[model samples]
Target: MTEIPLEHVHVAPDEESGGEPAPAVFVLHGRGADEEDLLPVAAELPDELHVVSLRAPDPLQGGYTWYELDLSAGGLESSQPDADDFRRSLDLIGESVERAVDAYGLDADRLGLLGFSQGAITSLSLLLEDPDRYAWVVALHGYLAESHADLDPDGIEGKPVFVGAGAGDRVIPESRTTAAVERFETLDADVASGSFPGGHGIGPQELDAVVEFVASRTA
Candidate 1:
């Protein structure tokens, strides 16, 4: 595996695994957020999961972002990703995950993904690009990139996918998220969805659902 190209941190498993490799969840934070932004929540997951949080490659206003957003003609709801930057990140992140699987003593068969906002968009894209790569996926407050809609979903059958967003979320728009859910369903993935009040962030109920979805697989 290649060296990890992005900065990252890890939360070790809660309990000792008797030296056996542990299942791991690779975490990605939203745009303008660092690796530490989701550390607290990633820790909330069951100790069985070894969590690795990665910082986005690009530096933004006091934070990091996975890719650049082109909002010149549209607002957040219609904003598009810089295709070149977005494509680059997809490859970068995928390579980092390969390195992580070996470096972190991660169980290759049970790898998972968790992402928020822009991070969520990237996570979903990675899963689509390689359907069998992850055991499950959790995406919050983000929408699918239109660029990835044409990918073949051949190996994604019965995949566990949880997508959540606030009904009032103006940042990504609930409609966009719902569209992602529908797309997953069309691919025959076992998708779980949640809608909460307010906008553009994870709510308490939403977080609990994410935890449960991951725990079931790890436990």
Candidate 2:
């Protein structure tokens, strides 16, 4: 894979005096959102963990986007025109993940990825493409992109994954979420799936569950 540079901002624990190597969590925001959008969620997590939010390479109208979208279908279209671009974008993310792990002195086996919307799709793709890269993955209000069925489940065996979506999410239908959950299960991932009452947005209950899962895995 080609090397991809990342622009990141770190959030350290409030109590840490200095120079402590805390476990790190990489946060990826949804389409048209920047790294700073999800930084606040880090506060909801355990204070001991470090949070790093990454910005996507491609800049959209105002913010950033993972890949091109097919708004008509509410899904990603993988044609020749967009296929290679998407793959390369994912590769960039993978490289960024490796960099974060090394830069933060995080345990390779304890690294985590948390994403929302398009960011969630990218997160799941990375885990599926390179299984065992993250100890835990939280995909909020996102679906597995095209060609996920062809992934080798053995790669992610025993990895913990939390998938949360709103029951009325229009951007990502519940059926897509169901398919993603089933696919992760088939891949032998320790998957937990839940739905909230709102639409295409994160709620407190969902965030709490994700925080607990990350703490349990890293602790």
Candidate 3:
């Protein structure tokens, strides 16, 4: 695999190479956080799985944003203006994953996605938009985008998905999370959901559940 600069995207191989193509997990960070934020979590996973952490394309005032936010509304305003950009970013990441699979000789059927906050939302969107691409998806403290409701159920056929949310999360409401879970179930995805007593972040319990879910699918 070609080595790319760790600017807006970072891709790395596992240290313990066994001369076999390694399964991969792509980590996406929340707004304001960079690719490095999720590197430690990569280390926590099986070293046999190559990990890649990607940064958002748009730069925020202080940190970074995947796409622009529109707060001028009755609810969250996700108009076409911002939606197009978000889709482009997802496409780029998807292409990157495909490249990694071919270059590393990794099994495309074993690809996984792990994302937190904004990244989690993107991850969910990617899987929903192009369901055949991933084996499993792990979403932490993120809600499905409004556009996701229109996705065809036939796209995701029994794909494994794990969603972890904080009951008291202010950014992503519990109600929204529940709705996302229902949406995934409606699409025939094998969904596992867990909620904890916290706000807007993950805990050890959620992490454990996510790891177990991935392990089960990859096993």
Clashing pairs in 1: none
RMSD of each: 1.4, 3.4, 2.8
How many backbone clashes are present in model 1? 0
Candidate 3 lDDT tens digits, 17-50: 5676767888888877778877776666765677
Report residue 15 deviation for candidate 2 (angstroms): 5.0
Of the two candidates 1 and 3, the one with more favorable TM-score, higher being better, is 1
Q: Write the per-residue lDDT of candidate 2 for residues 15-99, one digit (tens) a residue.
A: 5736645667788998888989898787787777778888887899799877776445434422211565678778777888787
How does each model score on lDDT? Answer: 0.89, 0.78, 0.76
| Count: clashes, candidate 2 | 0
Higher-lDDT candidate of 1 and 2? 1
The digit string of per-residue lDDT tens for model 1 on 64-151 reads 9888988876787888788999999999889888999888888898899999999999999999999789999999988888898767
| Candidate 2 Cα outliers beyond 4 Å, as residue runs | 1-4, 15-21, 70-81
Off by over 4 Å in 1: none
Question: RMSD of candidate 2 to the true fold?
Answer: 3.4
C-alpha lDDT of candidate 3 relative to the true structure: 0.76
